[model samples]
Target: MKQKRSRYIIGIDLGTTNSAIAYMDTRKNPTGGADAIRTFSVPQLVAEGEVKEREGLPSFLYLSTGQDLPVGSLDLAWAKERNFAVGEFARIQGAKVPGRLVSSAKSWLCHQGVDRKAPILPWGSDMEELSKCSPVDASALYMGHVRDAWNYLMAGSDPSDRFEEQDVILTVPASFDAVARELTLDAAGKAGITRITLVEEPQAAFYYWITDNEENWSGIVGPGKIILVCDIGGGTTDFTLIRVREGDAAPTPERIAVGEHLLLGGDNMDLALARLVESRILGEKENRLDSLRWLILASLCRNAKEKILSGGDVQQVGINLPGRGKGIVAGTLSDSINMEDIEQTVINGFLPDTRFDETPVRGRGSGICEWGLPFVADPVIPRHLAAFLKKHAAEQMDSSRADGRFPLRPDAIFFNGGVFTPRIIRKRISAMLSNWFSHDTDPAFQPLVLENNSPALAVARGATYYGMVRRGRGVRIVGGCARSYYVKVAENRAALEPGQITAACVIPRGMEEGEEMEIEAPEFKVL
Candidate 1:
């Protein structure tokens, strides 16, 4: 008889564009060592009739007709006869037919104005022709895939072992509100995940960095060092400011600040490229692209942008368009995304060299638009980062050091998410940031850019490290609540006025997880 596998601690990063899972066997690292961290090559269907294990599972979900695919083509170890694909195949096929693809469910998860529980994905798809899933349901499906992959990988070795029984750490965006967090928990339950601890994505990324520099984390990031975590993912760009302070035993890391959750990221870049392509293609002909055609073009531009960005030496990335009614080839309407396009749109447009005081400008309010994910109108990333720093500068640092010119400054920076995979992007941001810090007195002020390997898989790996730390093994970041929780109280006893409502902080910043707090204030009626 074979020896049964031991229980494992798993980490799941349910990202916007891609999702991943990592695990650590308790038997291998009985003491919860840092070397015990390893990720699962998620087994997913890459093609119509092919399945392969890959580093990260694409979050795109494809709703297919029951008769469209052959038997077992869409089958996984734990699922069979599924009329949908949830990984690599989903992304590839969905790009070709945009009407059936459910993308950016994570973004929709936080759209409180809209009904997240409603089955309205595949945004503008004809329901009679294509299947539909709710944003919550879509998220649950991705998590379900991760859970099933883990169980199948540990099949016969541990009959009693299951993901729901283990210590599982799931990561969410730091800016997710109460409703969104509760909905995430609900999704976990739907995915058969019984026991789980929610960790913020930015915090998870920091944990991975700490694990990477385990031996010298204390020495490297000493006391008073402010580490900025710039997490620009496929769908959103998040910033977390972690300040290291000298503890009784070792240096403790605390999440001092978290920026506003902006719907600005690689998706914006893809859309920008798509518009450029559309303009160039339409200018050559008198015909305009319909909604369906425009969606297809956007998908094509996204693929082209990725290829062009990844290919450092390559000058241009060509996109092939499907043939129209006139006599033409499928590749006739193809467009090329050149290096100049990337530098102009991404580097200059998104990551401009802006002043520390400059913030993103809100545009004039417009009439009601289509019911979709609310994205930031402005695409300037540096301005947003600067604005976030400016907001926390006065509170985080001493007023004496806070001159009018330089309000907030970070000692170190850690880049995370698939958006930072390209070296050009990393270099551009670093150079621009360093330039911002350069002043009259401090001409040589340069913030350290911490080296990170496998940016695509860092969050998932870090989440596993966080899980290990939770088990009382490695050095942990003592970060509590990133932001304070507040409750509103109406001032006027009669009619509500403009300045009637005032918010009282309940869970203050840096409040540790699992710690309870009691609000001590004047008696107020619960409305």
Candidate 2:
């Protein structure tokens, strides 16, 4: 007798700082129960000969010298030895030599000016002797590691349990442009993920919400209600607004708008803290931090910041700053992240409460600009939020949307990222949102209502559920691409005509992808 084929769904969260994989067996849960979803504990080396399993894989890669290690030192159970290291060991050890560490490759993928496929990562570093890789290559390495982990889990269990046989859902930032998305898809392809689909990270988070709430989701959310997903990862902050649409059976979620790509998040905060500590150390002296030492200190600041934010009841943290010598610790620099520091640095500086009409202010332009990642000059998060809402909620899009009202605001907010681990930041953002909502009515309403319990792993979980939904099992979010796409319309007019070159929107808001549209216009030379 022939054996029945096992069907499984895999979800991969390709994050900026950390990545994770989750899987579910449709064969086990034919009824589409959320409990079927389980996280895959990825096997990676935490230290030399100390292999351990972690829930999420740190999205980092370390170029190895291959001198001080034995054969198979960098090999996983399913993967052979490679010159580079990934996960915990890569993150922990790479901190000591940041020049070799390839971090924030996801951010680099979105940069337009740089050649993504070229080996230019570990950008602007003086690691000339060592080999460097492209952003796409870095992403593929992480995905390849996750793929190996999945295959390793199913190796002895079932012959048909290969990742190639399963449907995969890969999550990306909602703000990622077309090129970035394409690069991510290509990266997954290179990583041996055959059957895959790309879902926005914010949408994946909301899908997790749906799975978590289950039958109760319909009760909590109704038609016409908007939910804002605020995703602040290690490298970028993404905001996506999803509106609850009318449905016959259940309320369908439709993504209405996505925020601008802001290269400001936990990494920026870490850099700020590093600068603060550096100033304290130098005390306005002529001495400045060298590149290597500055890199090490930045890594330390990241670690210390995590401790201060997540470590409850821990008043202070200390870092043994390294000096210019072999195996030498200069001094133990201890500092407390006081409430005032948090307020002044993060709340006031990054997310200051602003009115709906307000927008982010541009700084003075410089003559000579540094060539690197494009960071947001203005740190005010509210102003960016306001701008996104205003831009998408314009009355012009009313013809394409179910709700015609301008200045649309979300009824609930979903927070996802390590930065939101502290209750203080969440509360501050909630207060700012409420202040914006207060302008509409006499009695103020709190718009930030939805709270995600598993902020760290929600994207992976939601993506797993999304894979199930793709197989016609669970509830599906209805919106396709969030933004309206347009093609430039060229007109045959005289010179100096302002309306000669216009744009014709080919894809309307909420239109599902792969839906073909025929545009009726005067045929000009296709540009």
Best by lDDT: 1
Cα RMSD of all models vs. native, in order, equals 3.8, 4.2
Cα lDDT tens digits for candidate 2, 165-241: 67888999988988899999889889987688899998999999999998888678788778889989888889988
Clashing residue pairs in candidate 1, if any? none
Error of 1 at 97 (Å): 1.3
Tell me model 2's lDDT, rounded to 2 decimals.
Answer: 0.78
Cα shift from native, residue 41, model 1 (Å): 1.0
Model 1 stretches astray by more than 4 angstroms: 1-6, 157-159, 284-287, 324-332, 364-371, 488-492, 495-499, 502-505, 520-527
Q: Write one digit per residue (lDDT tens) for candidate 1, span 3-80.
A: 333378788889889888888888767876557878789899999778899998899899987766787788876787
Model 2 Cα RMSD, 1 decimal: 4.2
Candidate 2 lDDT trough over 10 residues, lowest sum:
363-372
